[model samples]
Target: MDSVREQLQIFVRRFGLLNATCCEACCGEDVSLVQSHILFEIRRMGEPSMQQVAEELGIDVTTFSRQVKAMEGDGLVTRRPSERDRRVSLLGLTDEGRRVLVRIDRYMAEKIGQIFSVMTPFEREVTTRSLALFNEALAKVGEAASDGKNIACCN
Candidate 1:
């Protein structure tokens, strides 16, 4: 059996590639950079600033700022002054972003379905259990990084 750490690295790298490829096929040129900006900062969370995206990704603010500017050109994301705080521009996914995200979701779902199709029901059940364990372990790691704080899990 693979160690948890090894499997984690493989899972992240593989899924990360899948997402990147989907984004590249959906968008173009700077697709991965633009998609990362959305996937990490906007798609799942409420609108966040270019600054916030930079902080979360451990990148320089200027890098994400320029990336956001490029995405704005492609209509992937929008930046408008927040109603609550005019100084902080709210960064959000545009309709184009939402469409692309949905396509990516479908692509991933189809790919995952193909993987599961070869498995027996018992194998599927075991995979679900393994994923649950992986999630629990990831939550613990996230907590350790942020003083036991964790993200909300709808699941």
Candidate 2:
């Protein structure tokens, strides 16, 4: 049997999670995978602060800022000072961004549907539940590591 890390690595590769640009064909834009994630988060959070989105995505502020800047240049995102706090920059999606996000969503939905089509109904349910459980466990581990808890090293 493959080790857990090996299985995860294979999954990631198969899903194209590490690709540089993933949505050009589907969305008709040169959006990187990271930018797509940022767009999704911004749309989901509804004008979240730059820092808030960064923390949610587990990305450092500096790198996130650069990505956001590039996105803003592309007219896919807008950053404006919060009315209540001038220091805080809130993010929003442009119309173009929204369209692109919709395309990406459709593409992903189709891709996931195709993957799940091969499974039995019971298998699909189990896989969905297992993924949720795995994500919850991953979040807990992330929180513990962020809180300075020592995690065992493979080495």
Candidate 3:
């Protein structure tokens, strides 16, 4: 039997999570997986500040800022100073960004539907539940580690 880590690694590879660029075919833009994720969070959060988005994504502010800058240059995102706080820069998706995100969403939904097509209804439900449980467990682990708990490491 494959270990949990091995299974997750295989899943990530199969899902193209490690791909350098993911949106070229679906959205006609050379958007990296990270950039796509950034776009997604921005849309989901509705004009979140850069620091907020970065924290939500678990990315460092400096690196996330650079990625946002590149996306801004590509005309997919806009950053403007907050009226309430001039120092805070809030992010928004451009019209083109919305179009691209919609296309990517459609593409992903189709892909996921295809993947689930072979599964029985019961299997799909079980799998979805298992994924949610796993995600919750992972988030707890992240919180513990961030709180400076001594998680065991492979030596």
Best by the TM-score measure: 2
Q: Kindly list the per-residue Cα lDDT of model 3 for residues 23-117, writing each as its tens digit.
A: 87555678988899999999999999999998887778999999999999989999999999999999999998898889899899999899999
Candidate 3 wrongly placed segments (more than 4 Å): 25-27, 147-155
lDDT of 2 by residue, 30-116 (tens): 999889999999999999999999888877899999999999999999999999999999999999889889999989999999999
RMSD of each: 5.6, 3.0, 3.1
- lDDT assessment of candidate 1: 0.70
CA lDDT of each prediction against the hidden true structure: 0.70, 0.88, 0.87
Residue 99 of candidate 1: its Cα lDDT?
A: 74
TM-score of 3: 0.89
TM-score of each: 0.67, 0.90, 0.89
**Which regions of candidate 2 are displaced past 4 Å?**
25-27, 147-155
Query: Ranking by TM-score, best first?
Result: 2, 3, 1
What is the per-residue lDDT of model 1 for residues 2-63, given as tens digits with 9 covering 90 to 100?
59569756876766654644466544333673455455468766888766766665556677
After TM-score superposition, the amount by which residue 38's alpha carbon in candidate 2 deviates from its true location, in angstroms, is 0.1
* Global lDDT of model 2: 0.88
